[model samples]
Target: MTSQAITPSHGLYREALPKGCIVFSSSEGRAIFREALEAGHMRCYFKMAEQFSTQTELTFCGLTTLVMILNALKVDPGKTWKKPWRWYDDNMLYNCVSMPMIKEIGISFDQFVSLVMLNSLIIKSERVDELASIETFRDHVTRLSRQDDHFIALSYSRKSLGQTGDGHFSPVGGYHPDRDLVLVMDTARFKYPPHWVPLTAIWEAMKPVDETTGKSFQTEIRIKRTQYFK
Candidate 1:
């Protein structure tokens, strides 16, 4: 009989995990991650991923704005489309963050985001212009939980993250006393589903920062996961 290698526990796995590596224990955690992503928790998801991965700080305005756009669009992420999703340079940090990596891999930012978003097994909507507010989106998504949905399982390698910022927008994937970083992939170029580390999941202590120099910001959010109905 052949013996299977045993996987280590979270503590051992986490300590030995290389920087940027992601690990998940429970199917429930994975499911929630996917659902939160499809529901427009883009920034939140990224923050979570950062706990396990190395990351650079970004402006809050850009992050929050992206979330707002996604909330307004109200689209399904799982559905594939022929046309590329549209996002302005002013709103995204991809150029500043991923350009070096792309050059190393020989690709453009457009191509990178397109590839990542396309390869993502889970995605929300590209256009979310109808939602009245982030709070409204949150409320609306809360209602979506009662309905049936479906989702896919996909995983990828861990990676270091880079981000561009003008300091005018909300921060994404930044350090917070309440949150732990994890790898949350933005499969869509669209700004919805602020997916990242959930502060509440792996709780941390909070510290105060100078108001003028504080590197933190806030936005309203809503998340939904795919559901399977028999």
Candidate 2:
């Protein structure tokens, strides 16, 4: 589910860390980060951390993740953000669709990939629904996280992760092979922190169907690079 921020005044929603997860800001999360770094599994985490940004809108999680990957890869936005600096902004992520539409409906996995590609980033995507086995999903996340030029990101159901929203997107910071957990740098910084999650649980999280597109939450392991396609 969503890490939907709860208001102390409303008392209608609350954020809870169910078993099988730990936020990065916590002591347990700190240990996981320390160990992952010592093991050389955090090659891309540093770069991604340089570009971390929170989602401006509740449904802007996909776009929020998109800009992080883009800037982390150092892709030129082809337009100036301030006066002379070229950059990627959440508002600048509407080449494939209108920002108003995306703001209203968010984006599907396919739409996310399309937006990434349209902005000149090259990504290698895997269809989670068509994945042959959970082991392969584990392998993809494991292998990608070790490389310095690649980072893993995916969209999965909140319910599967024992959260309360809908589908969400975030980058996988690192993996602890021994503990079999993956780091999820959540875009909803207000709701959740960068958290470590069991690998199998993350795979299961992506298996749920998205009713909007009538497809599974198709996830991807992407290469971070700026490409000028001919």
Candidate 3:
């Protein structure tokens, strides 16, 4: 369902949780990394906010994830053009797509793919109508993490991640095979922080149908690039 379809009981369309509430630890920042090491999952790693430029706007999660992935891969967006072009700038992205468009009609899988391709990133994506099983989802995430890549999960925040929103996008930073939990590095840092949630929870969240396409949301995998944007 689209964000517009959601009927908020109290007039607030979305729910927000304070940082550290989800993970509940004094060392909330290091908890995911420490747990990943203990569980023998792929070593937890991701670029921090300082590594990339992003606006503090609420609806730019998809764009934020795109910038995060690009920065993580060492693709200098600012230098990708002959002249200084901050194409990856959040404002540029928001202006390109428009805030009203994003709010009324969420970003489509094809639109997201085109955005990444425009930046010269190699991306492969698929839409799974039914997740099938937790093991299937777990294996997919684990494999990606092992290969030093991350999956951009398009999920219903309320259904899948226990958040209070319709659809959201974030990168899976790490996977804990033993605990059956996955680290969701949410780009909406102003509202929610990165946290480890049950793998099953994410799988369910991804199963919802997109109102725009009448099909399920998509999961995007970024492959190692052999060439960079000039």
Candidate 4:
């Protein structure tokens, strides 16, 4: 687990966003969510394993995002579960079920809230329509990230984010008001590195229906209690 700073590069943008990327001013990203970017939160890691033994090199974006957010909030599942990430991922796989059904699908927004509730953490979440304007989405994320004890997780489309996937999940460490960009701490470190992306791109990605529930993905805000584990 390590913390690495990322600088904007033309090659990265060209590869990720061939259609052209939005560039924000330096001052725009200054007021980042410091707590979320702390070394502890940024370094938390999880990988999906096969049969709880061998590494499968599979995707567990939603579970990894949840672990990242919980770590950011200082909530240690390790206090309760021996192997926290794997435990949580297995729970999601078994608990999250839709009528149509897909095996080992990502957890939904509601399931995410339920999991946090089970941990006794204070949580508030809302669905962000994919069709909503970029400004509206930006305002929601900015306002939430600015609050003390608040950290955000989003489920969005990788295609919209210049990646090769349908949907993905990650924690939003900060928002750049001036540039309309958000600092996404991508949990799929095996594939994507942390980076700044346009709020609009995220909005478009989040609009699609999650195959598991037939509902649009969501942005969630979780508040940690100071004495939660006491």
Q: Number of backbone collisions per candidate, in order?
A: 53, 7, 0, 1
Question: Taking the tens digit of each residue's C-alpha lDDT, what string does model 3 give over 147-181?
Answer: 54343444444445556666677766777676666
Error of 3 at 55 (Å): 5.2
Candidate 3 collision pairs: none
Candidate 4 residue lDDT tens string, 1-230: 99999987754332343242322223323333333344233221121111112112234565566654554455545443454342333333333454233224555677666766765477766566634565656666767555545566777767665677676767766665655666766665545555667777777777777776788767544445454421
lDDT of 4 at 125: 62
Residue pairs with clashing backbones, model 2: 1-158, 1-159, 1-163, 1-164, 1-165, 2-164, 2-165
Query: Compared to the true structure, candidate 4 yields what TM-score?
Result: 0.62
Give me the displacement of residue 228 in model 1, in angstroms: 33
Better of 3 and 4 by TM-score: 3
Deviation of model 3 at 43, angstroms: 3.3
> What's the CA RMSD of model 3 in angstroms?
8.3
Off by over 4 Å in 2: 1-14, 226-230
Overall local distance difference test of candidate 1: 0.30
lDDT of 2 by residue, 1-230 (tens): 77987558754433767788897889888988899888878887888899999999988999999889888877888888998888988988887788889889998888888887787667877767553578877777778778857767888898898887878999888888889989888999887778889988988888888889888876655756745211
Lowest summed lDDT window (length 10), candidate 3:
221-230
Candidate 2: Cα lDDT at 2: 70
- Model 4 scores a C-alpha lDDT of 0.54
TM-score, every prediction: 0.23, 0.90, 0.72, 0.62
Candidate 3 segments exceeding 4 Å error? 1-21, 24-32, 38-44, 48-55, 78-87, 94-100, 103-106, 130-134, 149-157, 220-223, 227-230
Over 4 Å off in model 1, which ranges? 1-30, 33-88, 91-195, 199-207, 213-230
Cα displacement (Å) at residue 41, model 3 = 2.7
